[model samples]
Target chain A: MVKAKIYVQLKASVLDPQGKAVTTSLHAIGYERVADTRISKYIEIIFDETDLAAVDTQVHSICDKLLANPNTEHYHFELETME
Target chain B: MRVSVITFPGSNCDQDALEVFETRGHTVHSIWHKDTDLQNPDLVILPGGFSYGDYLRCGALARFSPIVKEVVAHAQRGGYLWGICNGFQILTETGLLPGTLLMNNTLQFICQHQYIRIETANTPYTHGLRVGTALDIPIAHKEGNYFIDEPGLRELQDQDRIVFRYCDADGNIAPGTNPNGALDDIAGICNTTRNILGMMPHPERAATDSVSSNDGKQIFRALEDYFTTRA
Candidate 1:
């Protein structure tokens, strides 16, 4: 089995209000050293196939089609083999 | 005019949209998201609410609904399509409309009456309205901030596709008047074809006097006029 781990985040150009709010909270709690915070989503999918090449293609396709929105987000994925 | 309102699971405003049209004496149909048929209506509306409980992002999951295929085809055929609030998010998800609705800058769900200025009267959706006409529409959403890339923003401006902008009662566009931190204070926009509109306001909620603001009726009237005059 192959497992795909994906990270999806708003494009750098887009504003992330939730991330900003977290940063504000951190600062309020005296974490002034933190420069910024950008929130992102992490997703994991397991495929029945063991082929890394095939899983890579499928993972990319899934991210483009549904897992992430290309308009405002950018996504990256890593593949790991599972016994 | 024949109108269809799509009802996705958790859609709360489907009936409101249908009631508004039915009261206007137009034929109205409620199309389920699972159905592939659109019933040959002249207009299709994706109503407001937390579809799929807004899971995986608002409107993201709902865009994959079977009926959206027909909705896309309908828009391609130049039929009128309007996405209100969550509906607007779905339109963006489906790529029928550009840009995305992000969470409000305040990080809170905002529900209140907002004044929006009509930016263009050239589209089928705003045919009879004059530019800069302010309508008292109600907006209710957690994610209503509209964002687009610089090039996309320029294209929308150059093509005159920005249909509505959140503004003051006096029709001034400013940050103070913007309920959400949308780029350019945009509240609504249309496609390059000018047939599809995605707006983050509930016109149906303000369509009757009982709602204390019938300003939204002007939009419905403009739609009816578009058909009646063309027919």
Candidate 2:
């Protein structure tokens, strides 16, 4: 079995309003050193198969095709083998 | 004219769309998202409201609904397709329209009457509108901020595919008039073929005289005008 951890975030060029709001609140609470803040989605998927190469390809496809918008978001994934 | 409004699980505006179309003296059908076949209506509308409960982004999950395949095929055959609000998000998610709707610049759920200047009257939805006319419509969404790559936006402008721009009451498109900070103040756009249109405003909400503004009635009338020409 394999488990995949995916992170999806809007590209840097895209403005993140939620992140900016969080940053503003942080500053109000006295986190003055915080220059900026960004938010993203973290998704986890588990597969029953043990084929590492095939799992890698499938995970990438899932991220590219569904989890991320190529126009505004980027994604990365890490996989771990299950004992 | 015949219109079909697709209703996804969470779609709240399908009935509104149907009412407006029917009131305009057209046969309207309510199609479920899971249906793979359409009844060959003259126009298909993906109405507003959070589809799939806004899961995985506004329209991401709804884009893969079974009926979208048929909708795409219908568009490929030059059928008129209109998407409003969340429906517009679905269009972008499905790649039927370019750009993406991100969280509002204020990071808030905004629901209010807004103005949009008609950029072009070339599409069926805007056929009866004069260029530069400002229409008051209701807009309600948290992710209505539109974003597109620079080159793609330039190309869309070059092709005159941009249909509407958020504007002031006098039809000015300055930054203050942009409610959601959408790139280029874009509120509505059409595909290259001009048959598919997606917009964030709710024309159906403003189509009735009982409503404060009936400015949106023209959009439905424009469709009828477009159909008359074809007939």
Candidate 3:
């Protein structure tokens, strides 16, 4: 089995309101060194296929089609093969 | 005119849109999201709702609905398509419209009467309205902040695709008046062909005087006038 871990996040130029609120709370709790915070989504998918190259292509297509909005978000993935 | 309002699994405003069009003496139909046919609608509306329980993203999953193919085809043929609130998000998701709707800056679901100024009166949606005319409409959504890249924003501006902008009662556009912190205070926009419109405000909810203001009626009236003139 092959497992893929994907991380989706808003682009640097796009504003992240939830992340900003978290940063504010962190400061209030005495974490003054925290200058920025951004929230992102982590997704994991398992595939039965063993071909790494083919899986890579499918993962990229899935990310572009459903996992992320290209207009505001970007994503990257890492694949691990498990026997 | 024949109008069709699409009802997704969680859509709550489908009836409201139908009622508004019916009251205006137009034939209205409720189309299910799974249905592949638009039934030859003169105007198609994607109403506001939390389709697919808003899983993953606001309109991401809903875009994959079976009916979306027909909706896209309708727009490609220059048919009138209007999306309201959640519908606006779906339009952006389907790539039928530019830009995306992000979570509100306040991180809260804002529901209230919002004043939006007509940015351009050239489109069929705002045909009879004058620029800077303020219409009191209600907006209810958590992810209504519109975002577009720099070049896309420039294209929209240069092509006059921006249809409405959030503004004060006096028609002044400012940060304080922007309910969702949409870039440039944008409340609504249309496609380059000017046949498709996506807006966060719910004009149907304010279409009657008893609801608050009947300013929303002007939009329907303008659309009716456009069709009449064309006929």
lDDT of 2 at B73: 92
* lDDT of candidate 1 over B1-231, digit per residue (tens): 899999999999999999999999989999999998899999999999999999988999998899999999999999999999999999999999999898899888999999999999988879989899899999999999998999999999999999999999989986689998999999999999888999999999999768899999999888888888988
Candidate 2 residue B204 C-alpha distance from true site, Å = 0.5
In model 2 chain B, the worst 10-residue window by lDDT is: B172-181
DockQ of structure 3: 0.96
Clashing residue pairs in candidate 2 are none
DockQ scores for all the models shown?
0.85, 0.92, 0.96
TM-score on alpha carbons, each prediction: 0.98, 0.98, 0.98
Task: Tell me the spans in candidate 2 whose CA falls farther than 4 Å from its real position.
Answer: none
Clashes of each: 0, 0, 0
Clash list (residue pairs), candidate 3: none
| Candidate 3 positional error at B113, Å | 0.8
lDDT of 2 by residue, A3-75 (tens): 9999999899999888999999999999999999999999999999899999999998998889999999999
| TM-score attained by chain A of model 3 | 0.98
lDDT (tens digit, per residue) of candidate 1 on A1-83: 98899999999988888899999999999999988999999999999998899999988899889988888999998999998
